[model samples]
Target: MGLIISIIIGLIAGAVAHRVLNSRGGFLGNLVVGLIGALIGGKLAEMFRLQVTGGILDQLVLATVGAILFLFLWRKIRN
Candidate 1:
């Protein structure tokens, strides 16, 4: 199902982001970050009118962008 696939992608993206960003969190935290990132990425893509395919690679790309943005904001706010 689409939902299931999305969740899997989110999880993977979260893990990748956490590792890349050196974020401190467990699996659930990573998942939350990834999910939020997905939402942010989707909105950003829409705002910028970016065209990305509905595939795993596309999701990963969006999630990475979202995660980067989230991490940047998180650091700024935490400071």
Candidate 2:
């Protein structure tokens, strides 16, 4: 289902972002972050009129970028 696919995408993207950012929070937190990032990324893409025909790969890229941005903002806000 679509829901399952989205969760899988989010989890993978979150785990990668976690390692890349070297930030705190465990797997579950990361998963939550990732799902949020996917939503953010979708909005951003829509705003910019950017469309990717490449399915999950494109979703992963956008979600990862969004996750990193979200984490960066979170750090700044926390600090």
Please name the candidate that would achieve the greatest TM-score relative to the true structure.
2
Q: Write the per-residue lDDT of candidate 1 for residues 8-62, one digit (tens) a residue.
A: 7778777878888887768787788888889899889999999988778998789
Candidate 1 accuracy as TM-score: 0.87
Where does candidate 1 stray beyond 4 Å? none
Scored by lDDT, model 1 comes in at: 0.83
Ten-residue segment with the worst summed lDDT in candidate 2? Answer: 23-32
How many backbone clashes can be found in candidate 2?
Answer: 0
For model 2, what is the alpha-carbon lDDT of residue 70?
Answer: 86
lDDT of each: 0.83, 0.85
20: Cα error in model 2, Å: 1.4
Under the 3 Å rule for N, CA and C atoms, how many clashes does model 1 have?
0
User: Roughly what TM-score does model 2 have, to 2 decimal places?
Assistant: 0.90
